[model samples]
Target chain A: MSDKRNSETLPLAWIMPGALLLLWQASSSLGWLSANILPAPLSVLASAWTLTLDGTLPHNLGVSAARAVAGLLIGGGIGFGLGLLTGLSRISERLLDPTLQMVRNVPHLALIPMVIIWFGIEEEARLFLVALGVFFPIYLNTLHGIRNVDPQLIEMGRVYGMSPRRLFRRVILPGALPSILVGLRYALGIMWLTLIVAETIAAKSGIGHMAMNAREFMRTDIVVLSILIYALLGKLADSATKALERRFLRWNPAYRR
Target chain B: MSKNNGAALTLSQVTKRFGDTPVLHGIDLSIAPGSFVAIIGKSGCGKSTLLRVILGLEPASGGSVASDSDAAHARLIFQEPRLLPWASVAANVAVGLGERGDGPDGAAAARQALADVGLTGKADDWPSTLSGGQRQRVALARALVSNPTLLALDEPLGALDALTRIEMQSLLENVWQAQGFTALLVTHDVGEAVALADRVLLIDAGRVTLDQPIYLPRPRRRGDPAFAALEGAILERLLDASVSAGSR
Candidate 1:
């Protein structure tokens, strides 16, 4: 059924996006919208080319990518660890879950002003913002995954005289992996968005900084180019994570395709 | 061999109650070593509960149940395969050995067990890819790998289609003959009970209402008079219980 649907819809996926791009170009050429505020696709391409040749595009991209990756690693690690603890140990859940829930309810983005004030608009502030954004989704999903594992499987393990550590390692961890992977993917996307926002507000150089600087000079072409780069980066990160997920969860039914 | 002294299992005055209702009321039974015993009854007759008690999965409400064998004396094969979705076929089978790092010989033992179930080639395959019959075979292999002294099957073939059910029945008998482990099977299928068991124990409302020996020979034909007679007797007992319940 999925095969038939994929084959039937394959052409439309390409054609729809192509048609949208053509319509945007036509509108801009016909002056339906001002090119100053919304640059033509060609103008954006030209600005992107110029920026690439000058090495500024690559430099800013590297800065943004590094910050996002760093934040994801730290935040995802901490979240996964804590999530496992809360999911497996009732004591840990009772001790930490209420406080975490209260803190999670407060939007991490709302702490931007305080974070900047505390960390002084440096790399620390930007990274911390990205980490904070990535943390909650991963943590919550991990906890959910661990909690939802089949009780039957756990009983089977116990009947086999499996040690507590072995039961957790062999059954609980693998059972929770799919959910944990979902959390990781969600956290990575949020990490990128948060980094962009943070860099736009305070960074000296990064894709977000480039977009902000272009806005200041009314270089709408550069702004559009930077936004395109952001979109592409987000797609690339998502695809990479999906590839890793496939490798790890090859036995999963969802990953069969 | 002094076979008379080898008591396989004994459940003495096993009384189980749930809340205010009694399930197994002072039930007592003794199984000899290397015997195939079938417990047949209608649903909610507490046959499955008896198997669970024997497996140590559930505690008895009253009286004591004991196995002459060691702690790893018996293993259960549930109606569903219940294979771990994430583990490979070999890993699932090896899980029977618990968490004792069985060194390098573990893989070989797992493979041998799978071979016993005619699934040697599919060792690395995941449970998701397996058919219903294949999954049940893996479950059987998992139970067998432990070399259990007593095998408790809780309607293990109940979920299979007719053709698959017959095939699994034959495979189970073959495995049982080869291993020679004492088995207590709880099944709703009367023909299955007569085919596999040397003795049939019929339970109703958690008590053993009937204990009859099956004198049918090995390689018993389903169409034979003796097989049909046993099947009819068990069916009549079950229907009688249902009718009694209805009349009440």
Candidate 2:
């Protein structure tokens, strides 16, 4: 019954977007909308099909995806490690949190110029920018999660004679996971946003670069296709995080349904 | 159900203070093995604080809190279930076993513990899925899974409604009888202390002012005049303590 209700409403969600696409297609085909400004959705699809056949789309997509994953691993790993450090130890939090808080306030995008100069427009530059963009949300959320774990539960763990490591593993980590996963989903959005801005400025190959290259030749179709690709990739990232949440937090009622 | 010998506890002039404020002032008490004792007091009367010190969650600034059982064989159930939200009920129950819980045998032990609390077929259920009373039962199971010689319960049923509180009091009595753990329950309710405890201690002004023994037999009926009289006397004593403390 729930499945039937979902199937009915899920189609309703698509109606507005479908209508907009149809309106755009009709206006472009009737010459009311010019190709130079915004090409019809079909022409964008055609460009995507052509790019796919030539292998450029897949190759660039793969490159961009690799960068996102690599940056997430490096940045997210460090953020988690640092979050643990500060969360578990008051001394560590006192020593490091203030500096991190100050640095966190500065927009990560503003560091791009310095990053380019330091890495000389190499892959490191884009990776560093993307990684920097992804780091703090995960870090802050992790710290908040750990610090806010019910103290009563920790006291119960102690009274039950749980070893320090076991207490952390069984109680603290799982307690913090819901918040950390929230950070991850937020970071995924930044992953694509950071990559888009990063790639457009520096990189030789990626969907962003394809759009940048298309701009000089006035191929508005490819530009629109690139934006669409980013949109689809962002949606894909959200779905993947939702899958992870379902797997990791099956015990949580919010995630179960 | 397998029963273990309950641990004997002896507190010799145990004093605990946080900063300048005194919580427990030279508390001296001896708990015999295989006995059920309830600690009852008004709010902020330090009964819960004493329970924490006895359970070793907090240290006594002076004197000693000693138990015959191994420190590993002691467990506490808080007012909240304190179950790991991300863990299944069986896994949460297994947490009582400490390091032993990591082993395969712990699985069967956890299931048995669940059954001990009449929580059959709920081993895999999340704490979030259970009712308040059921979750508290799971907390009881977790404390029981280790076959604890000393069990500390700090107002474990304080949040439940009246009917569930009565249900849990019987469950508590049954478990204490079967397992023979030295049960130390800290509660605010006079009737609960009378119903479940072999002896009830009332604290006021940071001291055990009234140490009363309830001579009523097992499965004592709440409707009995004897039960009501005992409850009323204790309630009067508690009110008297709080009122005098307020005047002072």
Candidate 3:
């Protein structure tokens, strides 16, 4: 019965997007909309198809994906390590927390000029930008998760004579996982946003670069297609994280359903 | 279930203080191995503090807290189940085994512990899915699975309904009998102290004022004449201590 309900509701989700697409197509065909301002959905798809055939779209997309993944790994590793350090140790928190807080307050994107000057208008600059943007949310959320683990459970773990390593593996890590995952999901969003801004401003390759090149030639179709691709990528990232959350946190009461 | 003979716990002038305020004042007691001892007191009378000192969770301000040098280990059960919501009941039970739990035998021992608690079929269930009574039972299974020589219960059934509390008391008694672990229970209930403990100690104003032994046979009922008499004597001591405290 629930499956039937889900099937019925699934089509409803498409209705609004479908209607908008129909309106876009009608306006373009009727000349009610200028082609340069916004290309029809069908024209964007056709251009995207052509780009796919020529391998330009796929190649740029692959470059952007690699950059995003690399930045996430670097930033996530640093954030998780520092978070554990600060969360578990007062000494570490005292030594490192204030510096991180001060840096976190500075808008990461604003550092783009400095980054470009230091690293040049190369892939390094974009990767650095993405990594900086992805770092803090994960750090803060992980710290919050670790700090919030119930003291009672920790006491029980100690009373049971658990060694420090076992205590962390069995108790602290699992307790902090839900919050860490939340941070990761948030970081994924910042990851794409940072990459887009970085690539659009300065890059020879990638989806953002593709869109910027399209603007120079007034190929609005490709521009619209690129934007749609980003939207699709963001949606895909979100769904992937949600799947991960379900798999890892099935033991959590809130996630059981 | 190993029957350890003679004193399992030795407290020599064990005193605990939070800064200047002393919670346990020169507490000296000896608990025999494989015996059940309950400490009873009003809230803030330091019964819980004594248990914490005995379990080595808290340091004594003065004096020493020692157990049998050869005792295998000690485990504590709190009023709350304190189960990890992110772990299954079986996994939570396995936690009691300490480092031994990370091995393959942990799962098998957890299964057996769950069976001992009469929760054989619910090993895979989440703690959230279990009722309050059932959760406490799981806590028991977790504590018992380690096969500790000493079990420290700090108001382990304080949150249960009267009926569930009575049932749990029996369950605790039977486990204590079978496991032959040194059981030290701290509670506020007079009847419960008399019902489950082989010896009862009353704490008041940071001291043990009364230490009485109960020689009643097993399956002691709350309504039995001997049970009521023992309960009344402890209650009278508590009342006398409070009266003296109030006047002082």
TM-score of each: 0.89, 0.96, 0.96
* Candidate 2 residue-wise lDDT, B104-138, digit = tens: 89989999999989999999988999999999999
Q: How close is candidate 2 to the true structure, as a TM-score?
A: 0.96
True-vs-predicted CA distance for residue B217, candidate 3, Å: 2.3
lDDT of 1: 0.87
DockQ of each: 0.63, 0.84, 0.78
How much is B153 displaced in model 2, in angstroms? 1.3
TM-score of chain A of each: 0.94, 0.97, 0.97
Question: What's the C-alpha lDDT at position A213 in model 1?
Answer: 96
Question: Model 1, A1-257: lDDT tens per residue?
Answer: 98999999999789988998899989999999797869989889988889999999999999999999888888888898899999999999999999999999888888999998999889999888888888899999999999998888888788777889999998899889889889988987898789878988899999999999999999999988888888898899899889988987888888977
lDDT of 3 by residue, A1-257 (tens): 87898999999999999999899899999999999999988899899899999999999999999999999999988999999999999999999999999999999999988998999998899889888888998999989999999999998887777788878988899999999999999999999999999999989999999999999999999999989889999999999999989998998777765
Candidate 1 ranges with C-alpha deviation above 4 Å: A1-35, A40-55, B1-7, B18-21, B99-104, B245-248
lDDT of candidate model 2 versus the reference: 0.91
What tier of docking accuracy does candidate 2 attain?
high
**Winner by DockQ:** 2
